[model samples]
Target: MSVQDYTSRLSDPASRKMGTFSYLPEMTKDQIRKQVEWVVKHGWNPAIEHTEPQFAMSNYWYMWKLPMFGEIDVDAIIAELDACHAANPGNHVRFVGYNNFTQSQGANMVVYRGIPV
Candidate 1:
């Protein structure tokens, strides 16, 4: 059987399998907003985190701030995401939804692509 080398393809940032939305095309602002809305609708707390591209696969990530507890404003959540990205322009920024009842993460996705480390 002929084997194929997929290493090169995987080197691309878009090709790296990191999070829920990584396999899909980059999401637009509207799509991000919709996701945030969904999270809120489900009573999940929205949070932002960032990490260097090299550590994208690692379980540990630097939280932008404490999980935005009781925050229902979509715009506020998006603003925080923007702020996180702005502060860490060279780091991979991600958005997550925390389900307090289940005491676990519900949704996790990379929202910003950072420069390769």
Candidate 2:
């Protein structure tokens, strides 16, 4: 499905993968760690982003923090992911691996969905 269609399905409370690995299933923590490691090895920065459930269609996801570059600590990235999820528990959160070698192109994966708490 298209990104718009997949995003619209978020209201159905389903998770969707985007950018790289869109053809594969949702990744496990180990898989994520490997991917992050590869991104860092390639000198790409890691970034987190989220969009409020109400604004899922706005296509205006907010950045959780500044992109992390030169940081190879996977645990730290995971921690930031957890913190972002806690703060926006009802939104859609994603982990983005940005490659500066190419402008405006990166690997994105939806990694969190806040259930009502």
Inter-residue clash pairs, candidate 1: none
* Candidate 1 local Cα displacement, residue 99, angstroms: 1.0
Residues 5-116, candidate 1: write the lDDT tens digits.
4443445754566755876688999999999999999999999999998777756999998999989999999999999999999999999999989989999999998877
Q: Which stretches of candidate 2 lie over 4 Å from their true place?
A: 1-24, 115-117
Put down candidate 2 lDDT per residue, 1-117, tens digits, no spaces.
Answer: 656344525545345334556546767888878877777777778999998755655578999989886777888988998899998888878888888878553777777754421
Score candidate 1 by TM-score against the native.
Answer: 0.86
Which numbered prediction scores highest in TM-score against the true structure? 1
Model 2 per-residue lDDT at 67: 83
Clashes of each: 0, 0
Query: What's the TM-score of every candidate structure?
Result: 0.86, 0.73
Segments in model 1 whose C-alpha atoms lie over 4 Å from true places: 1-14
TM-score of 2: 0.73
